[model samples]
Target: MDDITEINTKENRQLLYKYLIKMYGKEKAKELMFKHKDNLFGNNSLAYSLGKRSIVFYCLYFLQDYFVPKDDNTVRDLAPVHYDIWRELEDIFIHHTHDKQQFILPRGCAKTSIIDMALSCWLHCYRESIYTVVLANRELDAINFVEQTKIALQTPYIKNTFGELVQPRKRTVNKLELELDNDTKIQAYSSGSSVRGTSYTSSKGKNRVTCFIADDYISEADILSDESKEKKYIKWQKEVEEAGDDPVYRNGKLIKSGTKFIVLGTPLAKGDFIDSIKNDPEYKVFHKSVVPFDPDEYFENHTYWQKFKEIFFDNKRENPLQDAKEYYEANKEYMAFETIWEKYSHFELAKKYFNKKLVFMQELMCDVDNVGDSWFKSNRTMPMKEIENHTFIKTMLTIDTAGVKNKDAKRSDYFAFVVGSLADNDFKYVRQAHLRKFKEFDEYIKHVISLLKENEDITHVYIEKNTYNGLDVDAIKSEMVKHSELMKRDITFINEMQRKNKDDKISTIVDAVNNGRIIFCEERVEQSFLDQVMSFAGQRFSLHDDAADCLSEFANRIDEIEIMKNITTIPRGWLF
Candidate 1:
């Protein structure tokens, strides 16, 4: 039974019809032909009865039956496994390559292998004299496509059919171009230094491409950049759309095969292309595990992969613990994977562990358009609440005016004030706080002083010197003094100099938090203040000296509250 000459000979047609009957049971195959009775036409009634629609069905049915392997070593049999997923992928490639799609996948899936098999099948099985190109982030990865395809073609059935194995040309590195007796050409390329500026069509020609496969097209460099990411994605979209139109003949198929245009890598942060593409509705998304597991309902009751080694590896191997240690030591990347698993696993374990859609949409998949522009780092574990309830005296109130004076800036943290006191052993603790919208410096200062005076613990008032570009501090201080005079209390004003090294300012703040000396009020303390405490790496300090600034000012003005050596315990809840 020959597909190429099934139309040419009546005897050959009979043989092909019998093959189809065996492939799809006679009743089912007959039902399909009967449904397409009007579309079938030819000199031979049975041959003519198989219409265009039936031809497609018959072709697919026969292709599956003739080529797919059923049992173990399916990849070697040159017979396609009748996977519903592979069928859907084929339909998508057949129909939608012209429309650009971005694919997103979790790590350790067989995306690359699937792409390799698809590229080979699309070009070789269909599309005569078609030019096909495969590309990846690097030349080495591109070469792997060629290697994998050669492996696919080396399947026992394919080798038996062709009577020879398809092997890579030794001289032409990073390229595996295969030409059957027909002129169809398959070639691969790495998207590294050699192919960066080179466009595929210019070298391969327009109307010649049957398919273009690109895996991991966007590099890490492009992922990190502002403009480069957009430019690279746009270029890939153009190439795919344009290449999809390059059929060997009109109305012929031009396939672009890959596991979608996956920007494959571990997600580093929020604003990456993988994150961006997962939001797209146009792309048909699928996630299959390189390691398989069951659905969600079934997932919860069992731990398969995690427990596999614990149960089997110890007894299976000579030494189980040593074997586990060796495996863990060999894969350092798994450490990072485990770390992410710990933080994100509660929401993502069902997803990555069991291949389920992450239940939490806001955490797993983010909306691209609604992505945040501003991010604040905060910690609630070692919360500001820890600092909220502490004793303090000789408190100094200090404020750092927001650098910008826009109305919105005024609405934001325009005037950030801290009421801090020097505790025992010279450790300064913040007692009160106020930061909010205000236009007038005197008015803002008045509100701050009024808040402090109500506390009645604050004694010395210190104001940051460089406010409103160093122009308004004097007027601000004078207004504070006038307000005190009206209140009929003589409050001392202290002016503190800013530190030259911002690190020094931060150290002064960190020392207070580290020493458990500063206490915060529950009313104004926040998680962000706590986050600053926890996130103090102590070494790589930058862009976080505001809270430290307030701390430094308090430390500069207040001295230790000295007491008799025998008087060890200070009275609790005493505001001096």
Candidate 2:
């Protein structure tokens, strides 16, 4: 069971025969056992039989020497999971059970090299007059697949084993076509190319496509662009799927069969072509995300793994399949690494890779829903009151001021204030947040003075300086002079100016919120204030950005405030 290569051995064949006998009765098992025995013989027909029966054996044994890494000439075996997937695909191909198959795998899992190139070569060499068409998002990608197929066929190990069987009669890079000595042909086409009337001719004078493989038909750029998504959807339906209409024929006579279509790629968007195909009844979907809901359980109880046990060992379990929802319910703890923490990591990767969250979800988890848009979710926030034990180092007040004559206007920028303590230089616990629209400059000053009186720990008041709403040093100082008796403590008022864009400022707060560096008071902070902060789109200006602006300002200036807290005292004669 450990060594996959052992399945091809003679001793395992006897064991397999007995298992088959127990499952399919004596007569059928004898016929199957004889076929297996015949396939093990050292002959050309035996080689064909082995290749036809097991794709894993064909790749690992027959094509092992040829499929070496270009840089080091080292042969790396496919992962056990990959072999299991290939075997299932082989069964579908040999039995002609499904007309379409969709394979969703991670980025570097070798779906293109193993299945698109090596398996295509095996099919061409083993089957007589087989026709195939390879398609991709771009012309260059299609050409690469065709070139890889040619390279696979021309390898010394393959050429020596099959000799003239795999030799190309005509290999044209311009046309992206490869015609084998056995009259098997493969052509590559881009997604939008005209493939309506395309057909391959066999030695027996039959013309049709036997197989169609589409790799990465959706690109990341296409998913990001709304215009491109619309056009690509139309092209996928009109051109790629319709290309399989090439009629099959046997012995120069028309047949009722058509080409078997296989669409392979990581899902890009929620309702892209891959999603459409999964919803349609025509295609048999085979989706394998790199990180499932429960990573440990997926490795043990996946449907493909169960299928592998059934096919190879004739072992069946009562419960063989577990969907994403069931796995999440059973193993909720394991899901956090992928769904929550990794999403923040993905945000960093998106900055580095210059891609979006859509690409990250699709490539890593095969998740279709776009997640990176909302920088902060409601559940990510923790209540400050929930902290059981913490030392409060310093209390600071950050303000985003708005000016309006009317104190009861509906459509005006809200004056936002955030009073929080820097606890242990790591956590920012918000004690209170005051958010209101259409407050006069005098009333706003009185309100801030009252807050400063109430919160005696507040030593610094950081006000966002702007030309509008009479928010300036002199205006605030004049109001402070009027209420000098209330401000018994020497409060340092800092005129903070933001030099960066609003989006960049919001991103700073996003990192703090995501890393659990900030906490809000459940009772003191208004629900409306939290709602505005959570719902603020980082990219565009929303209807209300006061709460988000205040939080971002606090996050941006917290370090500076810490540096000030280190200063014990200032000379009374020192001028500002």
User: Which one is best on TM-score?
Assistant: 2
Model 1, residue 468: distance off in Å is: 25
TM-score of each: 0.41, 0.53
Instruction: Quote the positional error of residue 408 for candidate 2 in Å.
Output: 19
Q: Rate the local accuracy (lDDT) of all candidates.
A: 0.45, 0.64
Q: Tell how far residue 417 is off in model 2, in angstroms.
A: 14
Task: Give the per-residue lDDT of model 1 (tens digit) for 1-576.
Answer: 123333334543444456448547888767755654432223223432332113233233323333334453343232122243344444545544433343343342344654445435444534422556666778777666776665565543233224233533422323555544333456776654333232323233543454555566655566444566666556655554344442233355444333233233333224454444544575555433222333323433444434433422222244544554455455434422322112233323432322212212222332223222211122112234554444444566676665444655422443556776664333445656544556655566567657655656565666666554445545545566666543564455565455454433444444334323344555565445444435443223233435545555565556632222235677877756
lDDT of 1: 0.45
Error of 1 at 141 (Å): 1.9
Off by over 4 Å in 1: 1-25, 28-82, 92-103, 125-129, 163-182, 193-207, 238-528, 531-576
- Position 248, candidate 2: lDDT: 61
Query: In candidate 2, residue 314 scores what lDDT?
Result: 15
